[model samples]
Target: MKFISWNVNGFRALQRKMDVFAWLQETGADAFCIQETKLHQDQVQFDTPGYFQYWNDAVRKGYSGTAIVTKNEPLNVTYGMGIEEHDQEGRLITLEYENYFLITVYTPNAKRDLTRLGYRLEWGAAFTKYIKGLDQIKPVIFCGDLNVAHQEIDLTYPKNNNGNSGFTQQERDDFTTLLDNGFVDSYRSLYPEQTGAYSWWSFQFNARQRNIGWRIDYFVTSERLKRKIVDARILRDVIGSDHCPVELELSEYYGRHAGR
Candidate 1:
């Protein structure tokens, strides 16, 4: 199955800039997830041909949000992490398919100079705990703009960005702890030493033109689903938002594993 994820920056903005429906049809994706929608349900229409859509809009409209558009309906769907404090932003959504739990998350950004680092650190810990809790039940297929570059190789100006919000030591360490808990970065699993593979570019200083960006968007799956990974891709050619779409092609069937 082909599953894809992209941080559209803003749902309405992207819809205006490009034909999102056309692109989805071209990809033939079974499931499509998006982040940073920056819209509430009232501001937009949730219609897309051949797809059942689900959304988690932030309590604060025109801010962070997430959505899942799938060809097949889920057995069950969940919004946020079930923690009131974290649920306010609508940053997470989980779709329980027959064999796996597909989680789409938009992790909180640490902000410039780590101003929000404290809260983000707490979020990282809680988020990791949350994922581990899911891992215990079934191998997971999770993706989104996690907002952190886990290693030096993940961004262009790594040395200069060492202590920056997205590349900070604390944030990186927390992400490492998440991987340590059994999630594997699916793209890196196939292209281990590949470079210049980025998903999010800055709107500042010609970052996109120079390809100076971070590989923050990801398709991370539990180790148990390792063999199901057929391919992972970065859709740099597609355009609309500063972020690009990342995809994962898996062999795991909907009901063969932990499907409901």
Candidate 2:
């Protein structure tokens, strides 16, 4: 099975900039999970013929939102973590297939001033619990913009950016905690020591041109699915938003017939 996850920044903006449907056809992924859609469902009229679409729009118009377009229809679709406070932003969506649960999440940012750090941490803990619960039932594959660089190796200049919103010790520790709870970061699992591979770049100071970026986007799965991960790639060359798409290819053997 193949999947592509991207923080498109904004779906409408991306569509206006390029042919999104053509791009989707070009990728040929079984599923395309998107974050930061920044629009309500009715606002956009995107027609993807071969894919089923699921969208979770934020209460606030043109703000935080998520969507998934998939060639295979899920057995069930769930929006949010069942927590009202955290659900308002439409930051999460879970699709249940015959074998596993796939989730797309847009983790809240700590903000430039770190004002939302406390709330971000709170959300992190709640998110951890939510995914863990799903893991207990079946292996989970979750991907999207996690909004934090997990370690010093994840970003361009760790020392220089230390304590910043996405690089803070607390935020990083929270990510570690999530991985510690029976999950694996698929890309790191594949390329443990690989460097200069990134998913998101700053729009300022020619960061993308200089390749000064962070691997805040990811495809994470239950530890049991680690071996099935055929390839996890950061498609740095693909451009539409400040963030690029991360692709994950799983062994075809682990499809519907794969037992829990």
The whole-model lDDT of each prediction reads: 0.90, 0.95
lDDT score, candidate 1, position 186: 96
RMSD of each candidate relative to the true structure: 1.6, 0.8
Q: How well is each residue in 89-143 modelled by candidate 2, as lDDT tens digits?
A: 9999999988899999999999999999999999999999999999999899999
Q: Can you write out model 1's per-residue Cα lDDT over 212-255, one digit (the tens) per residue?
A: 99999999999988778899999998889999999999875633
Clashes of 2: 0
* Global CA lDDT computed for model 2: 0.95
Query: RMSD in angstroms, candidate 2?
Result: 0.8
Clash pairs, model 2 backbone: none
Error of 2 at 103 (Å): 0.4
TM-scores for the candidates:
0.96, 0.98
lDDT score for residue 156 of model 1: 95
